[model samples]
Target: MRPQLLALLARAPAYGYELKQGLEQTFGPAYPQPNIGQIYVTLGRLEKGGLIRGQEVAQDGRPDKKVYEITEEGIQELAEWFAAPTEGPRVRDEFFMKLVLAPGTELADQLTLINNQRRHCLTMMRGLNRLAAEEQGNRVSQLLIEGAVLHLQADLDWLERCQEELT
Candidate 1:
């Protein structure tokens, strides 16, 4: 959230409400709606950390508003965030742990667990397909949905491998 706000500020100076609106407009339905309170809190933290400087601008008839601009430090941090490669999903995930540990315990069988997970993944893919169709004109939303569908496909494939090897 901090980095996102910094990136937005790097583009132009904006107040808290404007930042919230910008995120929604930019990401569309692909990104979750940010909490306004959370945004203000993050802005305060950034100001204290010297990543941003806020200026109080008096309005004509309303209360004063604070507009925030990115500091040089904020720009550097945003650059680092852009350059860093994100880590892939973990291999030892919840399903894998359950599959490996279930046999020794009183939990359900490994094959049953794999089948259940596969069903869930397919259901999710179906829902994503519907969302993708609805968001066809929105490239960002479409891309995000496509990525989720692909990940679900990979999980289904892995489940197949588990079924063959374990059962």
Candidate 2:
């Protein structure tokens, strides 16, 4: 959230409400929208950290609003973030733990666990595919949905591998 807001501020100075609206417009409904309170809290933290500076502007018949602009340090940080490669998805250890420890616990059947997980993945993939279809006009949302579907497909494949190994 910090980096995202910093990047937005790098574009132009904006009040918290403007930034919130901008994010929703840019990402559409695919991205979770942060409440105004969350935005202000983040802005306060950024101002304290010196990544952004806020100036209170007076308006007739309205409350004064603090507009935020990114500092030089924020620009450098944003540049670094753009240059850095994102880390790959991590495998959840909870599932692995369940698979390995099921025999010791009352959950003695690992096959059932795998089957249930596979079913869940398939159901999720179907929903994501439907969402992707609905978002076909929006490339960003479509891409996000496609990525989710691919990950779920990989999970399903991994479940099959786990079943083979365990059996």
Candidate 3:
């Protein structure tokens, strides 16, 4: 959220509400919406960190609003974020741990766990498909949904492998 806010600030100066609106407009339903309070908290942190500068602007009839603009340090940070490669999911995931440990304790059958996970992944893929349809015009949303669906498919494939090996 910090980086995203900085990216928006890098574009132009905006108040907290305006930044929230920009995020909603840009990500649509693809990303979780950050609440106004969260935005302000983040803005305060960013200002304290010297990544952004805020100016209080007087309004005609309402309270003054603080508009935020990204600083040079913020731009450099954003650039580094853009250049960095994102890490993949770790091997020691919750499901994998459960698959390994649950059977020894007789808590749950491995086959049952794999089947349940497969069903859940299928259900999620269906929902993502519906969301993709709704956000057909939003390329960013479509891409996000597509990525999620692919990850789910990969999970399903891994479940198949687990069943083959354990069951």
Candidate 4:
């Protein structure tokens, strides 16, 4: 969220509301809507960190609004963030933990747990596939769905390996 907001501010100085709208427009529905208070809090932090500076502007009929602009430090931070690779998906999911630990626990059969989780993954994949097909024009959404499908496929494969090992 910090880097994203910095990137937006790097483009132009904008008030908190404008930045919020910019995020919605840029990410579409893929990004969840952030609370206004959250935006203000983030802005405050950025200002305190010297990554951004906020200027209070007096309005004619309303309260003064603080507009934020990215600083050189923010741009450098954004560049460093862009260069860093994102961490891979978690291998030790909660479901996997429960499956491995359920043998001696009061939980039901481990195989049944694996099967139920596999079914849920398949269901999610089907829904994502449907969304991808329906949103052919929305490239961003399609890409996100495709990524989800790939992850689900990997999870299904991992479940098979778990079953083989546990049984």
lDDT of each prediction vs. the true structure?
0.91, 0.88, 0.92, 0.87
Deviation in Å, model 2, residue 98 alpha carbon: 2.1
TM-score for predicted model 1 compared with the true structure: 0.89
- Whose TM-score is higher: candidate 2's or candidate 4's? 2
lDDT (tens digit, per residue) of candidate 3 on 86-128: 8878777899998989877877999899999999999999999
lDDT digits (tens) for residues 1-167 of candidate 4:
89889999989999999999888767555456798899999999999999999999999999998889999999999999999999887877799788878887776788999999999999988877776677777677667777778889999999999899997
Which residue runs does candidate 2 get wrong by more than 4 Å? none
lDDT of 2 by residue, 30-145 (tens): 67789999999999999999999999999999999899999999898889999999987676668878898898688568999999888999998888877767777787777777
Give candidate 4's TM-score: 0.84
Clash counts for the predictions, in order: 0, 0, 0, 0
10 residues in a row with least lDDT, candidate 1: 25-34
**For model 2, what is the alpha-carbon lDDT of residue 96?**
74
| Cand. 2 TM to true fold | 0.88
lDDT-wise, the better of 3 and 4 is: 3
Top of the candidates by lDDT: 3
TM-score, predicted candidate 3 vs. hidden true structure: 0.95
Flag the better candidate by TM-score, 1 or 3. 3
Which whole-number lDDT from 0 to 100 does residue 104 have in model 3? 76
What C-alpha lDDT, on a 0 to 100 scale, does residue 105 get in candidate 3? 86
Model 1 stretches astray by more than 4 angstroms: none
